[model samples]
Target: MHDSCSSPQTCTKEQVVASAAPERTRPEEGHPLLEPVSAGEVRAEHVLRDTFGFAAFRPWQEEAIEAVLHGPGRVLVVAPTGGGKSLTYQVPALCLEGTTIVISPLVALMEDQCRALAARGIPATFLASTIEQGERNERERGLLAGAYKLVYLAPERLASEWLVNQLARIDVSLLAIDEAHCIAHWGHDFRPDYLRIGDLVARLKPKRVLACTATATPDVRREILERLGFTQGDYAEVLRGFARPNLHLHALRLQPCDQIADAQVVRAEV
Candidate 1:
């Protein structure tokens, strides 16, 4: 069941949680998250507070979110870890009319996010080899029935024609590629499967596409955008510099006896 509140601003966290569970079904609420926002109706503050329980968006997050909702659906967000990059697409996923598919690299990452979203009273799930076959079947059923707002999948999943065909049957509102820097050849951890994403986007033609990463050099950024089918006029790029003053680096070298003494001292302090 979706939240009864038609107005997102007035919607409560309780309402969000109550409507998020997949096991329950209700007649009043048409969807679990809430009714999709009408054109020009999505407000960043409303989504931040009501859906995500945040008072506001982070510095550059608001700009990226606004672009996804109002401007071109193609966006690239380059913000460091802990910068709320997930919220950029997650917020819009709730506001949009259909499911949002996030292409992630790691099963653990997908599972972690899915669990977090579920805890927040958001309908989110992930597909991976770790899931039991029976549970996977149930999730697939839920997906086709529009039970979730966000679904996380691995980039390699794009190689399956069966999966792609199944996805084509649904109304995919947003396609988010996390760790998008991996799409570029020069990226630190490049994957060949990522090269297939641009073609997948072309075939699915989801309403919007969001690429996110914490680290991407200028050349890598360009390569990523090009691979994701973003021409000059087709996308918006939100690049925020990474500057963490709190992080400090120090180095220490010690002989075996000195190291043992230091370890003993630390253990005694603990």
Candidate 2:
């Protein structure tokens, strides 16, 4: 959520990568994951259409989901802000047998996502500093009993040995790192806590990993992959172009006298 302002403002190059939306397609276009599943198998498109109520996958989302569900190892997705990055992992979380643990930085964002998922009949929860101790304990118990399909937690929560030990006992299929650019020193919002994620992954050893972000330079991307224990040949990458014809960028200048005119124009538009 970087702001663009007039005069002497700093911005990341990644923000300029926006592009027109590419043609949307389902995984069945070519991916094996789209094949018809048997009785016990999980079909991704079914989850997309039935669970989330989306007809088709956004550009690059199907490929990213395929990589996570069927690829050999980890996956990294660097899509634009409105590029449906959450589905890259959320869809897989539903298809996979075990739970998916999402590591995010913002408690408010976690709550919002968890609430939306719950409304859609998806079992999701979060534990953050904002919650009361009693409610936190209830969520912890629910998480341990395999009552949730997705669990959102802050990186700080991993510092707790007790919590980590409890998580170790569950069947964690995917470890999704959202806003993954924080792990890189060159990122605009580098965080020291994210550096410990590699160790956490090593200890927890989830079956697969998925790192996602909206903006990242090549150097930052490299640092994130290395930090997440992804080797050159072992992981998959899904990088969608950021060009959208519908998206527009504008910068305007105004003096004290111009404010009145601006207000009048805004009022008319409203």
lDDT of 1 by residue, 1-270 (tens): 124444322222224455333223232331122123476766668878987789877767887886677654568888878889999989988778789999999999999999989988989999876789899889989999999999998888788888888899999988999999889999999999898898888788665789999999989988987887655233567877666667766556878879988878767965
Estimate, for each residue in 1-270, the C-alpha lDDT of model 2 and write its tens digit: 122211122122222422211122122331112122246878889999998999999757877776677653378888888779999889989988878999999998899999999999999999887789999999999999999999999988887889989988999888999999999999999988888788887777665789999888879888998888764224566776566778777656778999899978867965
> What TM-scores do the predictions have?
0.76, 0.77
Worst 10 residues of 1 by lDDT: 25-34
lDDT, model 1: 0.77
Score candidate 2 by lDDT: 0.77
